[model samples]
Target: MTTSLSAAELANLVTAVPGVRGIEPGIGSTLRAIGSRIRQQDPRQARFGVVVEAGSHRAVIEIGIDGSRPVKEIVRDVQETIIRALSEAGEHDDASETRQDSDSSGVGNRNTPQVTVRVQSLL
Candidate 1:
């Protein structure tokens, strides 16, 4: 069985990375936040800048960097951090109840979401 991943949880993890500034707010996220407020939901919980596509097991993350590290290094760290967190969440477990081997890039089995990190700005 596949476990559901929460974008808010993932956002928290990403933001905790040393060189990460915060999630970059895009138009979609902004609109979602507004809609969530209208619906009386916490916009912060509703509109974390991470987008998870569960069907395809993919996550697109936009973040701002502190500019204290190389962009490539920071981006790679974000991807690895996300993959690691998902793996620990049992998101990469196979149908046979076995853990799959993560590749060098930290991508696990089909159940694991492929993480894409985009740096939107330098803080």
Candidate 2:
């Protein structure tokens, strides 16, 4: 489930996520990191792998984060990191914290930005 995302973007996501440790930055920062490096022919997880699903406007990339990390924390980190990456990549949703109504679009099919996280492992 490697991706076409950028390395710098992936590293930043992993570094910014709270509770993420021993996150081999050289390997990848987030699911996108696992994806990016694999895209370039990384063989670290040649057999054991990530599985992903996506929609036209969003994606659900899965990874095997170890057990110690709380699911809540992982979810928050993923959301935050995705938002940060999207913002950095210029994918603006124009969601202003002060203008809730005008920013609902940032949440989804309604035009807002949003992310959904799922923990598929602790191995």
Candidate 3:
């Protein structure tokens, strides 16, 4: 039988993703709360926002960065990291989660049920 993830577990997963830099301690709690109200999207992180949508099995993610590194690179890194960490966590019990840019130019990623990262004037 498969097991679902708790909010804390989810946050742990997020922090583990590569290029994620750091996740707020409340990542799991915020997602859990926003997941109910936001319906399609939620946001997190301080400097760089990392957005995620997670269902029982699958999840989608996007990372927003201000400068320094290209947004495409950041998104790719987030996608790879999230996929790797979550897959390893559950042994690929869930379908392969898809990661893509939400907007053109591939700078921003999509907002999802699980998480959304907004860069409030990136540092």
What are the TM-scores, per candidate, against the unseen true structure? 0.68, 0.43, 0.39
lDDT of 1 by residue, 5-117 (tens): 56788898999988999999776666766776689964334455776655576677889999999898999999989877776666344444654454534434466558888
lDDT for each candidate structure:
0.72, 0.43, 0.41
Model 3 residue 35 distance off true place after TM-score fit, in angstroms? 5.5
lDDT of 3 by residue, 12-121 (tens): 55555444554432455345555655564333311122333343334433233445666556555555555555545554543456434424342231221222333323
What lDDT does model 1 reach?
Answer: 0.72
* Residue 68 of model 2, lDDT score: 63
Q: Global CA lDDT of candidate 3, please?
A: 0.41
Q: List the residue pairs that clash in candidate 2.
A: 2-35, 3-35, 105-111, 105-112, 106-112, 106-113, 107-112, 107-113, 108-112
By TM-score, the better pick of 1 and 3 is 1
TM-score of 3: 0.39
Candidate order by lDDT, highest to lowest?
1, 2, 3
Could you tell me the lDDT of residue 36 within candidate 1? 63
Best candidate (score: lDDT): 1
Please estimate how well model 2 matches the true structure, expressed as its whole-model Cα lDDT.
0.43
Better of 1 and 2 by TM-score: 1
